[model samples]
Target: MTPFEPDRSEDLLNRLKQDDKQAYEKIYFTFSKELLYAAYKKTGDRVIAEELVQNIFISLWEKRQDLQINNLQAYLFGALKLSVINHIRSLVMENKYMEYQMLTYSENHQDTANLVDLHDLSSIIEEGINSLPEKTQEVFRLSRYQHQSTKDIATGLNITEKAVEYHITRSIKRIKEYIKNFYIFL
Candidate 1:
């Protein structure tokens, strides 16, 4: 592939800002492969790398009018870096939640029937939690599993108490809805 000329890149950016599909397509075709490669190198997962690259392009299109990108390559790479970091952080949190659940279940349950029921319920709850948005999942795990207070979560996450409360409430509502839907399907 030929390198994008500085003048051509500026023109493409201008056309992209005006919602030109061809310009967007050109940008995607130009940078997507490299972005995917970088993401894959960082994540070691082809599916996740492709997803992250796709999200970056989608965001670029969605926010074209509002973006002020003097260096598109740098911006895209930076976004990829942050996305990988967030993904890793999310995986860590999920592993912690699973470990906590396993410990709690093993320590408290002895009867076979109780164990079966608990396993089913735990699976349902885990699915519900996984369906939540990343920040909400984090907030819910911190609040419920770690037993952190709202104030503490807010402080730790660098958000206001109100935001922490909002996330907790939203997570609970969504998880309840998920559980309800799951039972209805059963």
Candidate 2:
């Protein structure tokens, strides 16, 4: 047997296809740092990036039997890019889902006071709002239930305009999260 050349990725690929553990470790050691850094740069979270890298490499190993890659690094990076894109999309998907839920709840609520009065759901929403931190809950109620302007809320709360906006955004996110959980019960 000729001596193995670590510089030749084709040789590594061949060895990997044969389920050679050492070759797998070599590839992982060679590329894991770069892959991790790439994932982190895109994700902004070390734990998530690390998990993404691990999952990608695990998939590579699992599919080694039939995998044909002329450039393994490129293949892995492509997979990572897709993973990051999907991950980022999932956040938007969550917000979109929350909007859809709120819309559905409102429409159904308005359409059928006779069938199912929204008082019960309103109570749930109220509960979600009440669960917010005191200042946040107060700020949200003033903005939403009271229809007060941001300036009014800020002046009343003795906080800055930006702080009021931040509180409102935080409250909305928390309320949406709570309602999503409440929806599971329904």
> What are the per-residue Cα lDDT tens digits for candidate 2 across 1-186?
123344578988999999998988888887888889999999999867876787677778889999978777778789899989877886787688667756776665746742453576677688888888999988988998899998998898889986786677667667766666765665
Measured with C-alpha atoms, the lDDT of residue 162 in candidate 2 is: 60
By lDDT, the best candidate is 1
After superposing candidate 2, which stretches have Cα over 4 Å from the reference?
1-7, 106-186
**Superposed Cα deviation of residue 4, candidate 1 (Å):** 4.9
Q: Each model's number of backbone clashes? A: 0, 0
**C-alpha lDDT score of every prediction, in listed order:** 0.80, 0.78
Q: Specify the highest-TM-score model's number.
A: 1
- Model 1 spans with C-alpha error above 4 angstroms: 1-4, 107-186
